[model samples]
Each structure stands twice: as structure tokens, then as C-alpha cells.
Target: MRLELSTMRRVQRNPPCDHIIRLFEWFYTEDQVILIMERPPNSVTLFEFIKHSKGHPTERAAKVIVRQIIVALHHCNVCGVHHNHTHLRNILINRDTLQLKLIDFGGARLIAETPSEERTLGAVSRETAVRSGCECLYRVLCALIKGIPFWIRLSRECTDLLQELKNDRTWNTLENILDHAWFKEASTVNRGERN
Candidate 1:
């Protein structure tokens, strides 16, 4: 498990996301692996924040958090990595600035050209159907927009994106996805609705 975590962490470092904690260093001791990670002051988990506030967050706050999460996911997918365990609990917020950061990549997997036949729930194999970057982007875009749970979402997206990537030559980039008109419209709509 520790080895898996370390691999995921390494993969995460390749394409760092502003919404993710920066992993600075790692070392192995006699019995434990020391992962030196950035420590954000006044940070709290999204679950904690929601709990303290009771149920959902304020509309303004939720929008901010959600946007940050989507940005993080976009980066991960674009980097050919899948963070298969994203949820409120995995999100951390800096209380002072209300900035969001994603934590825990234990479930992350590198996207590979050949999809592995090894099958298991919550397990990722390298074999993906999509062979093109654009198709992968489109699949990831759809997943982000849908707000699907991380575990089930990645597998589905991987299969779909692999197909799309093979067939489509054009795919949206993270910046474009973030700046898409649909997202802007959704943000506007969400902003208007109070928790």
C-alpha cells in the first residue's frame, strides 16, 4: 500500500495542480515511509468545514470549493493520472484564504496505452481504450461536469476516453474546459441558489 501511495505521489508531482498540496520530498526509514509534504497553515478538510457549518456550505463558498476541485481534477486527467478517490473528505481548505487543496492520492493511477486486464473494484489497470490526447480530454471534461464520484467515475471515463481519444483528433485543454461557457453559466446558476 505504501509503495502504491508513493507511486501515486510521484505521478501527482509531474503535473502539479494549484489545488493540490505540493509534495516536496520522500524517504524510507526502517519501518515507515516519510512523505514530506507542504503544510498549509489554517488548513481544514472539506468534511470538517461542512460539518462545522452543518450540511452544505454557503452558496458562494461551495462554488469556490467546487471550482477548485474541478480544476484539480482537470489537471490530473490531463496529466494521464486518475485520482480515483475524490470527495469532500479529500479536500482541504485554507481557512484564512479559503483556498482549496486536494489531499490523498492513494487511489491514483497512471493512464497507460494498454489497458490492463486485471480487474478489481477501485483498482486501475494501464489498459485504456483511448489512444489520443483529445479524446481523453473530452472524456475528462464530461466527468468533471457530471461531478461523478471518483472511484466509479475514473474507470468509466478511462474506457470512454480511450475510445474517444482513438477516434477524435481534437480535445479541449484544461484551460479551455475551465473557461468554457457552460461552466460559466453553471457557476452563475449555482451562485444564485442559496444552500
Candidate 2:
């Protein structure tokens, strides 16, 4: 609770952003702390959304969602907040507009508090995550593109890029991942925008 409060306070110092959940107010007692948070109507966890969507989203739909997640991460990083924990369960997505809000900062760390060596280790872990395509961003990618059986509905460019992430000697940074051609491909449709 204390960690979350500190992270929220750090973010509160920054300019307003649409990606992170807004913290309206907070207070604490001896035993408990209270946080007033913005609750978007008709929003559900990304975990629930994926489960309801039959275990995976279409590539185009996944791109939209991933894009927003990336934007949120970028915004948080710019605010010196490193969300050490990012997963489906931690993200809230609106069913109607497909807007996303990252939540649960209990394990968040400020960039300055993190040592340079640890950041390098994080890069190594990122490589491992990409190699397996099962952690970090690749987990979502594998699930979304490969479906339940972990195969099918994959495009050539995307496959190659995933392979690059796995086989490349040097690990790619998050920004580089965003710059990849696969992510830059023209959006074919906004399939996830539910009525």
C-alpha cells in the first residue's frame, strides 16, 4: 500500500495523462490506506476481455490494444515510473471505446531508485522473455496471434519480427519494438471497438 501511494504521488506530480488511472485523493489510518480512484464505466480487466473473446483477439484488434498499452507504458516511464508488473489482470479496458488504464502499482519502482546494473539485467530478462515469447509483451503477442493451440492467424512480417526478437544477439529496447515495421503497419480495421 505504501509503495502504491508513493508511486501514485510521483505520478500525481506530472501533467495530466489519459493513459494512467487518475488518483483523486488518498488517506491513511494506522491499519489501512484509502485511495480515491477514477472508475471508468463498463470497464473490465484485460484478462476478462481476452477470456470473453475466446482466448485471443484478432491481430488488428490486438495491435490497437497493444498500441495503447505501449503508450501508457511510455507515459509512465516518462514520469520516472517503472511498472515492474504489467499483465492482463493489471489493465482495465473499456468494452465500448477500447480505452485502457493501467492499475495496480503496488510493485512499481521509480527509475532513479533502480540501479544501472538492474536495468541491464532487465534487458537480459527481456531477451529471455522474447526468446520464449511467453513473458512481457511477447506473451500477449503469442496469445493474440497464435490463439489457443499457439498456432494460426499469424502474418509473415509479424512472425519474422517475433523470430528476430528470439534469435537476435542483442536485445531490442521497448522503443525499438514500437518502431518495428509490424507495429507500424497500417491499421486494417478497428475490430475491437465494440458497439
Candidate 3:
């Protein structure tokens, strides 16, 4: 609860992205804290979305969703909010618009804070969560697009990034990952829209 409150306060001061789940208000008693949050109607978890889609989303659809997730992560990092749990289940998508909202901040932490042995809502560290989470999503995209196992057609870039993540040689920052060709193209579109 302390972590969630502190993180929300920081984000409230420097709002991250429209894609994040908005916390409207909170009240606390001696034993419990209740947060009133904005719930998107007719939403489903990314896990369910993928499952219902039969493990396939169109290339363009996947691109749109992935870009939004990347943008949200970039905002989090800039605000020093580390989403220590970034699995598909934590992401919600509208069935019609396909818009995304990242939820479940129970594992969130400040990046600058010193690491302690305390258990988070998830067991993974911040760095590991980001790397593994992004990699898994990327692989899922590949699997969906190609109709084959991801390992069968791992691109050089994917291989390199996965290797770096496994070896613990690189942090694979969201901004850096966004620099990849696919994401760079998406970023260009976003900038054009803003301009």
C-alpha cells in the first residue's frame, strides 16, 4: 500500500500516459485503504484477448498495441515508476477500440530506490520484469503473425536482445527498445500526429 500510494503521488504530479489506469481517489481507515479507479467498460485482459483471437492478432493491430505499451513504459521510466510486473495479464484492452490500459501496480516501485530483500507483489526484480515482459510480448507477436513457434523465426534483433537479457549485460531500457525499426516507425507516426 505504501508503494502504491507513493508511486501514484509521483505520477499524479507528472502524469504519465493516457494509457495508464487512472486512480481517481483514495480513502483510508485504520485497517484498510480503498482506491476508486476508473474502470473501462467492455474490457478484457490481454491474455484473454489473445486467447479468444486464437493466438493471433493482425500485424497492424499488434503494432498498435505494442506501440502503446512501449509508450506507457517510457512514461513510467521517465517518472521513475518501474512496473515490476509487466506480464500480459496486467494489461487490459478494449474489445472494440483495442486501446490498452496497464493495471495492477501492486508490484510497482521507484527505480532510484535501493533494492531490498522485501517481496514485491511479484517475485521478479524491476530489470528482469521489463526485459522478460517485453521479450515475451514480442515473441507472442511473432507467433501470432507467422503462425509458427517464435523460436523458428527469431530475427537477429530479437535474438540479440534476448541474449542480452539472458546474460544480464544490458538493461534494455524502454526508450532503447523503442528505437528498434518497428517501434521507431510507430514513434514517427506518433510524433507526426503531435506536430
The models' CA-based lDDT, in order, is 0.55, 0.66, 0.65
Best by TM-score: 2
TM-score of each candidate?
0.59, 0.74, 0.70
Instruction: Let me know the TM-score candidate 1 reaches against the reference structure.
Output: 0.59
In model 3, the worst 10-residue window by lDDT is 186-195
Q: For candidate 2, write residues 1-195 as lDDT tens digits.
A: 987888777776657567678899999999989999999889999888877865446666677777777667666655666777888888898987789888888877665433574575332233333322223466665555654234444556566656765565353435555776668766233334232
For candidate 1, lDDT tens digit of each residue in 73-94?
Answer: 6676555566666666777888
lDDT of 3 by residue, 23-132 (tens): 88989989877887889988999888877875445545666777777777767766767776777788899998989998878878676433553254333355654665
**Predicted structure with the largest lDDT when compared to the true one:** 2
Pairs of residues clashing in candidate 1: 114-127, 115-127, 115-128, 116-127, 129-162, 130-162
Pairs of colliding residues, candidate 2:
none
Candidate 2 has a TM-score of 0.74
- Error (Å) of candidate 1 at residue 45 is 0.5
Q: In candidate 1, where is summed lDDT lowest over 10 consecutive residues?
A: 125-134
